[model samples]
Target: MAYKFEVYTDKAGEFRFRFRASNGEEMFGSQGYKQKASAMSAIESIKAHAPGATIEDQTK
Candidate 1:
């Protein structure tokens, strides 16, 4: 796959997710969630909203 979401527990034992590319480089990560369901919901929200997201390009 060109990209994917990975869920895992941190050293602190919190649930978190990271978005990665095919080359296994991380693109971004989510804040830790108390429950796995909350983390999954966050992923779904991103999937539903990302397609319509605009690039603000604040660096310009």
Candidate 2:
């Protein structure tokens, strides 16, 4: 199966999304959003624009 991705309201009330490889390794990229729609959009965009890329590293 593809890496499992997830989105939810963070404690800061912002929308948070993340995904990890099968080995429990996160993808690489600094990504996040303040809105749910943006985060969702990012998920699609990332898949399209950065194929095979992972958010293994990001900044808060």
Best by lDDT: 1
- True-structure lDDT of candidate 1: 0.95
* Tens digit per residue, CA lDDT, model 1, 3-60: 9999999888889999999999999999999899999999999999999999998997
- The list of candidate 1 runs beyond 4 A from truth reads none
Candidate 2 structure quality by residue, lDDT tens digits, 1-60: 568677777767888777878876877532557778998897788778886766776675
Q: Where does candidate 1 clash, by residue pair? A: none
Clash count of each predicted structure:
0, 7
Listed in order, each prediction's TM-score against the native is 0.88, 0.63
Best by TM-score: 1
Pairs clashing in candidate 2? 26-56, 27-54, 27-55, 27-56, 28-54, 28-55, 28-56
State, as a TM-score between 0 and 1, how close model 1 is to the true structure.
Answer: 0.88
**Model 2 TM-score, 2 decimals:** 0.63
Candidate 2 scores a C-alpha RMSD against the true structure in Å of: 6.1
Candidate 2 at residue 16, lDDT? 75
